[model samples]
Target: MQRKFLDYFLFDKKDNGMLETLYREDETSFPPFDTQEVSFYLTPEKRLSLKYPAGEKQELSYQGFRDNITFILESPFAEYFEILGSPYLDLEVRTGAEDLDLFIYRRAIDENGKTVVLKGNHGEPMDSFTRGCFRLSHRDEVAKDFDKVRVICQPPTPKSGVVPGQIYRVIASAHTGLNMFARLGHV
Candidate 1:
């Protein structure tokens, strides 16, 4: 399972080193988390349909995209809280661009407050409408406290309804991981 989990984004030399440092210093490591994905049509009507992955990779739709955002915001996952406090990943996103410099770093804390930071390499944006995976460490041996990464989509303020063709931003953070999918996704 460790090797299989490592195969996704760990093969790259940079990712490999990050993983090594993570595992070496952290006692509890977590597997990746994925949302149920659907397909989004780029029409004016904003059509969304469900899609089941036949093999491995999953496709995500736009309605599914909206639902995902709501779930992430509303869900009480530990990762969400952790991310809120960390210098995780904050991105100024531009759709269909490859020059996004996304990175993560440990936040600094003092009597004043917390300070966010950007670490090593800023990741390039994958193509549009793709979910970015965040790898975070869990706290307990049972891995109850988990870290998290998230993509934040910020659009121009809506005139009436949610605006279209605006912009989406991505930020990643780690707090605690959520067991939302455990017990057959019953959470």
Candidate 2:
């Protein structure tokens, strides 16, 4: 019973991807569909709060981070549409640092459009904040006909450079989530 349609923001990969969306009028979101992917930093004091693992491993430098954010919904003439539970992502990941963990992927397009993509990898032990929140899924085998959720918080890119990629921050509003509990997050 969740049919209220029309929720925008089809593409946005802030700074780290260099300003990809601000809802351009009739401009069709101008040549900025996240500039071919490069993100890990969404402003408001670059958010990510849920820590307790400074076990010892330091060497940070995520040049202009810009973690992703793509929430686009436009399907409501039924025939098929189902997503129960909330879409949440106020995240936290510190899988022993050094290429931490958390990378979510999902893209759907049905109703005759045909499209699906699902990839999830959260480094085990997932992390604190009481295992913080990171539950965002529409899996009926990728929502079977259309239901896309795009929340990109890096980490898990090793093979050509053993370690360096994990900065999933998001707290600059919500009163910085009570001065940053970083919220019980997910994507």
Local accuracy by lDDT, each model: 0.28, 0.29
> Scored by Cα lDDT, where does model 1 land?
0.28
User: Which residue runs does candidate 1 get wrong by more than 4 Å?
Assistant: 1-92, 95-97, 112-166, 169-171, 175-187
lDDT of 2 by residue, 84-163 (tens): 22233433332334443334333344345444222212112222211122312211222222224342232433332223
Where does candidate 2 have its weakest 10-residue lDDT segment? 173-182
lDDT per residue (tens digit) for residues 87-164 in model 1: 233222332332222222222222233222223323332222112333221111112232233323224332222223
Cα lDDT, model 2, residue 68: 52
Deviation in Å, model 2, residue 127 alpha carbon: 29
Model 1, residue 132: distance off in Å is: 12
- Per-model TM-score on C-alpha atoms: 0.18, 0.18
